[model samples]
Target: MDAPRQDAWKDEEDLLLATTVLKHIREGKTQLEAFQEVAEQLHRTPAACGFRWNATVRKEYQKEIQDAKNSRKATRTIYSSSKSSDDTPMSLDAAISFLKEMKTKQFEDYGKENLETQLKKLNEDNEKLREELKQWEAAWNEMDKLVHWVREKRKSESGV
Candidate 1:
């Protein structure tokens, strides 16, 4: 039998009720007891008090769940191996000679890893740009089609 408010429950009232409910629960009161007390104090039903309590607490736990998921991803290790195309058999001396020549011809490339990473980033950026371009082109094409249709209708109506 409380007066109806133009807006939803006020922030101060919600915080006060939530604090009271949490305190009662922390003091070893059952949820039912805490809910009843909060419901009476807030001039709301038991269900409404329970709903608000759940909304407030659920948000906090949801954040914690997301934090745990992010931490798990950060702690994981990724491994990858490159494939080689050599399938022919060669003598040990020839293999060693080829390896030595290959190593010498290729400068000690400290930047190889960096180059590959940059290439991957560039490829991803290119894909994003391509997608945006496609969307823009589609929108422009639709506009052009609409304009042509309108012009054609106008010409027919004018008997040209």
Candidate 2:
């Protein structure tokens, strides 16, 4: 009793939009800020731009958010290689090493956060793709039925 379906390309557009928004949100920006910026830039509504921030995406970025907060705090301790040499102050090598260590720590934390966010985004994308595939299959099936019905009707009318 339902009407036949037509070809629809919904997922492709959704993917493009989703990826763009996800990239922005992952770049250490707030969801609302990213959404608003992306939406305005892309000439889209905020709601349409926000579909990428689903539960799955939120869960993925949650850890990164915590890590970022932790990373911002001072974890470096200034140590002078020649402690007795107060006049000389900290050695250049020691200062360099300490700075490198701090940089390394910040990088590692950000890397982990970024990785988790990307993984979550990938999972959400996969889910959306699967849903789109299902919709396509259903639409194809409906179209096939309609075509067969039309063929049968034409043959019968032509006495074939």
Candidate 3:
């Protein structure tokens, strides 16, 4: 449960995480996406960001979170009544408008450096996962071999 001293979350970083999460909430995005965004900016893992939020930062931002959720609900209500269904593709104009809206909310808030950080984090995570998968596979193969040996031993003992 203890974070390394060098990886401690600072006040500014906590504030950044909170605000980013709130904005994502207002935009109707998942908290995990917010954690991923903050992970890059904070140079930490998304899981770390999420843990910090749930364990400490979230308590301080309850009111803001509620407000963001309310705003998101209102926005959804406005869009939900539209004739266009999810199965149908949006028109080019609608797509443009949606992207523009997202740009105003996002590009103005986060700097260019954040994206490079996210990509770096993603690469690191990918390598870590690959290594972990290899370890698990090796252990599984060993277990399979042991089980096969045990079964053969039993069969030989039974003269089958």
Candidate 4:
């Protein structure tokens, strides 16, 4: 029992969504990211874009999706191997994918390094906090002992 949507997707919008999704796949980005990008362009929510893609557009682009994944794999292989043939000229798609792959690697490395540094700082802070807590606990125990001793001495002196 769903209400009818006021605005329907046009053919061009569907095409745009399809192509953007395929391009994102080839570039090693997720479909949700593609949906967000297309949503911004189409003035729709990402959920709407994702629904439209899965419900309608995606069925038509199955082959393209496979091709995009293969292209991404190929791009990775091309960049990872040092033994590519110099006689063979690289296509524009391959060149662009190569650059994208490199950029993705740099971003991943930076993220890992940044996370390690944060973890080191957090561990140091945690150790400091533990030491501080132990010191406070020792001080509290000493204060408790002093209070008990004072009360016992007063009781002994007053014969209470």
Which ten contiguous residues of candidate 3 have the minimum total lDDT?
88-97
lDDT string, candidate 3, 1-160, tens digits: 9757986778999999999999888876789999999999878999999999999999999999999999876665544445646665644534554667777767866756788889999999999999999999999999999999999999999999
Supply the global lDDT for candidate 2: 0.61
Per-residue CA lDDT of model 1 for 64-86, tens digit only, reads 44554454333221101124354
- Output the lDDT of residue 41, model 4: 97
- Candidate order (TM-score): 4, 3, 2, 1
**lDDT (CA) per prediction:** 0.63, 0.61, 0.84, 0.90
* Ten-residue region with minimum lDDT total, candidate 2: 73-82
List candidate 1 segments past 4 Å from native. Answer: 1-7, 57-160
TM-score of each model, in listed order: 0.32, 0.38, 0.49, 0.53
Best by lDDT: 4
Instruction: List model 2 lDDT by residue over 35-154, tens digit each.
Output: 677577667676656665562344555665555434333212324232443454544544565677778978999999999999999999999999999999999999999999999999
Which residue runs of candidate 2 sit more than 4 Å off their true CA positions? 1-103
The lowest-lDDT stretch of 10 consecutive residues in candidate 4 is: 85-94
**Clash totals for all models, in order?**
0, 0, 0, 0
What is the per-residue lDDT of model 4 for residues 45-102, given as tens digits with 9 covering 90 to 100? Answer: 9999999999999999999999999988987797656797666666676677678777
